[model samples]
Target: MIAYSRSIRGIERTEAYARTHPVNRYAAYPLTAFEQTPIAGTQGNRKKKEEAASQGVYSWLREAGQGQKLLGELLEKLGRHNGVASKEQLENSVHTLVDAMNRWESAYQSREQLLRPEIWEAMTLAMRHPAMELLGIKRGGQEVGRRLVWDPAILPQNPNMEEVNTLRRVLLGSEGLLMDLKRALSYAEQYTPMQLLRQPFIHMYPYVLYYGAAQAYHPLPPRGLIMNKTV
Candidate 1:
């Protein structure tokens, strides 16, 4: 299993710091007063910008939520099967997951200011390796067993407080599921489905617990709040 002790400790430290230093009231409104209130003939342009920003936020939340849900479903399915899933099923699930991730990433990129820069950077980096792995799996054949080509620039960065904690919990849970699936794929190649059946179900309680806790946290901003800002 991928050890998350370091990540967890980092999250705890960040949370403590956040407790001591609260976000500024105006941090959420990055736009200047002039930008916030459209002047004269710029009303039409400002209206379009607000609409786009609103849509971007909506898309990000929708796609991110869908990806999380799909990840949970895949984990539950793997737990049920004892990590003996067929390659085809794994490929399909990974494809869907990657697509949703891509959509959300695009949405987030369009509105990076919606989230704290540190949080956005952390999330993007956290997603890269798994996304590469999942894409390789989707391509099948020699790709599935290939080593990850770690990017030198993809180093870990500090995350902001409660949101960071929620993100880390979700990332760890998803990473565990991805690792399990990759292992199962390897086993499938060596043994027939019948032979794979004898393998014991890997306990997935930790993944389930992490995912459950992250869900309870609701890291994303409320839709109404986001809309209000755009308006």
Candidate 2:
């Protein structure tokens, strides 16, 4: 299983800290942003699980199709959107949609930031293997020349709490994620991205496409995340 790190100071503890210090705003925007977003119903969660399971078979075409469908729906809705209604009704409807999108975006971004420690830990685990020096996505706090496409150097070095948060923002943003994913998929290997999708770690899921391509060759890649040897 892809072991994700549990929070030492969970949301409740952070809330308590915030409550204790009234004036001290928790500037960790990603950490404390959407504590109240509603989780999806079982059906929705199951659908995600099913989709992921389908992707685990190295079917990039199918996975891309699903993503395209979702994006198409979102765009179709946006294209047809018209807020015309009774003043209060229009306000309420628009507000609801805006709020939903905001919550989703915030929550999605938080996954990476919240799980930064686990990502680092996973990288540490990956580094222990000698092959890491060659197969690793990063090294010496920078992108290795082995995969000379997208620069993982865009990420932080020996990421501290603050730097980790920034790295998450850079990597987890919709555009950034897609860009790196394209680079990873540049090679023509089917199972390259599959292994990444199958990881039990939540944070590592997004990275499957990015690192999967780099480690697509024989001797196979490690199950854990690759690191830059920062630690």
Candidate 3:
């Protein structure tokens, strides 16, 4: 086409070339989509299924709560807190921290990132949807908006190991994930302070509150994580 267009390629075959060979098609990039597994246990995957049966959730929550508790104190000390973190920062952090740690050898094969693309695919699929959907959280509104609150309370239902694993893969394959997350949360605070105190206030999760404690004190203490009332 360009060859026949004088304006594009300095050629003069315009009418002749077009009539002889009509352009009929275009190409598109492949959709790198994830292949999700069913909730039901399948053959050879029993272990992965039962893994969900364990009290992994309770343990995770306990640990997370402890982390948040600590984070709350830390924030009070730093005087840098405003409110609960918006969904974007939380999402970014998940990718950043896990990816940074994904490089090490794991116990299983599919669990390993060097070979399996499914792990990344699964997460990419989840990310395409709101993070809340796969996690079974009560989701509303759009995360891409200027503000979207991530209520820790809405996240404990579904084991998001698959999602987390995906983040680990991306972050591990490259560097700068963690720092990127930190900077994102920080920038959101600066550019859109409302990002911290916006609508749909999410109740803070324990571990996050503890870890980010230094970042959530005073005017925005862990206790005030859920601003749904006044918010």
Candidate 4:
């Protein structure tokens, strides 16, 4: 009985080791060209590649900043919750965001120009889903997806509690979206694009899939949580 238990433990340990270090399973085979490269040389090459990729993203981001600014302003206006703005104001904001998206797409077709091939391919695939849409661009005289729109009926002065709650929910959702966007932009600015690739897998949202991964390393708690910590 003791011998059987020991054998089982050894087998389990060996399996776990194999799972964590997959390359060890192929130790009997001769090293490939890539495997034969010196560790330092490989790392240096990776670093350079990452730096170049990050620079591409950085330049694209600078141009995308205009869209981000517009979104931020809209978020701020909604946050105030005084009352719904005129239809013209809301339409203007939407049009501006749409134009920004079109400009960004035209300036650098992300599928062709951004990030490493695999990264961009994955992003393109992910962005095609309907749920993944946010301020989608106009492509070839057609709209790809619709941007977020606030409920015009919701207002602080409204007597209906349900409507007020609905507005709160919308604002909260919008805040979350804006926060993720800002987080991604900030991360790309501070660290290499490779760092983003290393971040833990989260959602497929552009913000989360790209720059938002950095949020795992530098977390910013909510305002209420921060206040609680101070107390």
- Counting clashing residue pairs in each candidate, in order, gives 0, 0, 23, 0
Model 3 weakest lDDT span, ten residues long: 101-110
Models sorted by TM-score, best on top: 4, 1, 2, 3
List candidate 1 stretches off by more than 4 Å: 1-39, 83-85, 112-119, 128-231
Give per-residue CA lDDT, model 2, range 1-231, as digits (tens). Answer: 334555354456666555543343543323222443434474776688667555433443343344334434433433332312123332333344333323323332344322223322332342233322222233332443222222333323344666434433332334333233333222223334333332446536446645676688534233222322100
The superposed Cα distance between candidate 3 and the true structure at residue 105, in angstroms, equals 15
Residue pairs in collision within model 4: none
**Candidate scoring better on lDDT of 3 and 4:** 4
lDDT of 3: 0.34
Best TM-score among the predictions, by candidate number: 4
Pick by TM-score: 2 or 3, better one = 2
For each candidate, what is the lDDT? Answer: 0.45, 0.36, 0.34, 0.45
Q: Candidate 1 vs candidate 3: which has greater TM-score?
A: 1
* CA shift of 224, model 2, Å: 16
* TM-score of model 2 vs. true structure: 0.19
